[model samples]
Target: MKSSFVFLCISATLAVLTITSAAPGRGNANATIPANRTQNGTVTCAGLNDQKKALEGFIAAFVAILFFGSNFVPVKKIDTGDGVFFQWIMCMGIWLCALVTQLVLSFHPNNNNNLNQTVPVPFEPEALLGGFLWATGNMFCVPVIKCLGLGLGMLIWGTVNCLGGWASGRFGLFGVEASLPGNEAENFSGVALCLLGVIMFVFVKSEGKKTKSNETDDERAHLLFSKKIQAETESTTLKDMSKASDDLDDSWVDRLNPKVKKIVGTVMAIAAGLLFGVSFDPVTHLEQSNCHNPQNGLDYAFSHFCGILLTSTSYLIIYCFIKKNKPQVIGEAILPGLLVGVMWAIAYGAWFIANANLTQTISYPIVATAPGLVSALWGIFIFAEIRGVKNLVFFSFACALIIGGSVLTALSKS
Candidate 1:
């Protein structure tokens, strides 16, 4: 009942936001406005438009933070063995959600004229690069969770991801146009505060459930004996044993030394953060470059999702081959993986909208670090993962810093 209620609430909230965001004159460039004249007889809708866009951008950012922080909750208790297969399934869900979004935008009233002529949105293949980068980063999620726990791992990577993404847009790295806010000092301070908040998150210890090694000697022995009984011939038994051996080898990460494992996990988290931080580069490039004649950021959704699905599928195929057709496939993880993917897709879509309306400079810091606040709330209230006065104090301070930073960043845009 609790899960159902939460799901309904989330659905209703998303629906409301969708309607509010899609309201006429929200972000429509060709929106017709009433000509309210100022004392000097100049049209005064520009200020109103800017204010509306800013409001929409912040709303979209809030949605992004909420969904991104909670997307993995569905799979928290499910065993996603090895993660590769699960990721591919998740990408399928992402693609499906994007397809739905594409259809909605393609048929939007804005795209139709008085005669009902529909204007088609072109698919930009360059947007696929962003999806590829995101999928690559996502491949490390399971390992990071296993090694550092979700809270610590998310904090470390979230900090890096926030900084890298904000810097790229602020400075116009990778061919994106530089986004300079009205108040540079305030913007910089806001980002610094957000970073400090993320760092503080790393210090607040959580008592979440820990993962254990799946491989056991008894299980291997049982598999060997089972294979022997199922075999009709000695050659078949040998092949079965070989497959079993390959299955055991698939858990090589579990066999690493504890110190080495932590190091590997940290490296993977950093790498993922870098990849995630730059995942929007392709879209930003397409929008800014004259070559692509960029459309709305949402127009690239389908192609971007296509890229993610294709890349994840390729990785799964490679993993299957490496495992000698013995890949660890978790039967129960499929639905949860799909649900997580859908949630992620919605969050990412909102992120694209936020970037379009607010620019990455203002959106990056808030979108990236604010999710930590949402996740912390979940840990404290829902999962009971965080306890004790010290941790609560840290959480409170971190929330204050993050909220203040976001407010400053938004003000800087003015």
Candidate 2:
């Protein structure tokens, strides 16, 4: 126990050091950014250096996609007590990760940024609203993953998230100005193709809901028993463990029928996507609402993370009361939670950087497609979530649609 605590402290210190390492040289990066602006009011690359900004945007999109796809990997390691408890710790980690960006951008000299003169904005706390909304939406993630499997779950939510976020930036939803790429029709086409890809995957038939034919009830019970023993230390026979398991399966989520599980999973995934669509709402709101110093870029990252922490905490508090002050506390969640938080922070950091350098129309679609691809890959190869030649064929076609759509979206900006 002490060792885990010590490890977490060291990891956190490293996170700070890693983020701060780039602080002094931020100007080096700022030098690369183009001074781009849209007449509609969103901040993106100035038309002056189109090729350069596109390249930078693509890079940021790549990073965001990779990290976002893998952020939940740590949660798979330990059994989260009630998921809410796990989510709370995960959000705490996310907040800590957000601090890295907040510190770097807050303390760094912004005068040197190439876009400074054009954008002329300062950090705004309104970004907190974006984070808060996102946190509220994110609470459904664990359940979604459990229900849909990573591939279908991520694909559905990611595709929908792409639609919402891109539409918001494209048409200026919720007070944000529209982001017009050079080719509006082509941009819409890309989003449509991605949507098509999601539809294809929907029919791909992931055999995830099927229980293993070989595993008997006794074996399943033993595995659960062993996990509990490892998580907290208990020595008992299989019969005793089986008895304990019968009494503990009380949550409605645990009692879901397979068909209901599929339906609920799909619904939860859609909810997650809708939430993701608006996760950045507050930041956009600041730019559109013309709040004080109405800045764009990484400056909003800190407050956004704080919003996540705040919203998540509120949920946990409500949950405590709902469960009669018996919140399921997962002790093993700390280090993994921190790691996952950093992963998301890094991904979001890259996303903010992409927002600064790329057209929202292009960046959003490209980013949205790739993470679903990544998660699908993990599901297929790592978790055996999908198999059989028919499924593989559909998977290939779906991937083609996603990749093709992402390319189309990126080209729309060009």
- The lDDT of each candidate is 0.79, 0.71
For residues 1-414, what per-residue lDDT tens digits would candidate 2 score against the true structure? 457446545644564453333222232333334555766876665454555555666776777887787776666546687688877887888888776556556555554445343222244567878887788778887777778676688777877798888888888887778888988888888888888887787667655424486664456667887787666435767787676565465566657898999999999889889888877767766644643342345667777888889899999999899877877777877778777787777778777667656646678777766676776687788667678899889889989998888888877876
TM per model?
0.84, 0.76
Off by over 4 Å in 1: 1-43, 111-115, 147-149, 208-250, 291-294
Worst 10 residues of 2 by lDDT: 21-30
Worst 10 residues of 1 by lDDT: 19-28
For candidate 1, write residues 1-414 as lDDT tens digits.
Answer: 368537934773474358335433212445535554677976578667767867778777888898888887777667687889999998998998888777776665443245344445568889999899989998887788788777777877787799889989999888888999989999999999998888889779877543355644456556776776566355567777676555545366677889998898899889889889988989888777754353467777788989999899999999989877878889988977887788888888888888878989999999999888888788888778888899999988999999999999989997
Which segments of candidate 2 are over 4 A away from where they belong? Answer: 1-48, 113-123, 143-156, 203-222, 226-247, 254-269, 288-295, 380-387
Residue 253, candidate 2: Cα error in Å is 3.4
How does candidate 2 score on lDDT? Answer: 0.71
Q: What is the lDDT of residue 261 in candidate 1?
A: 86
What's the distance in Å from true for residue 362, model 2?
A: 1.9
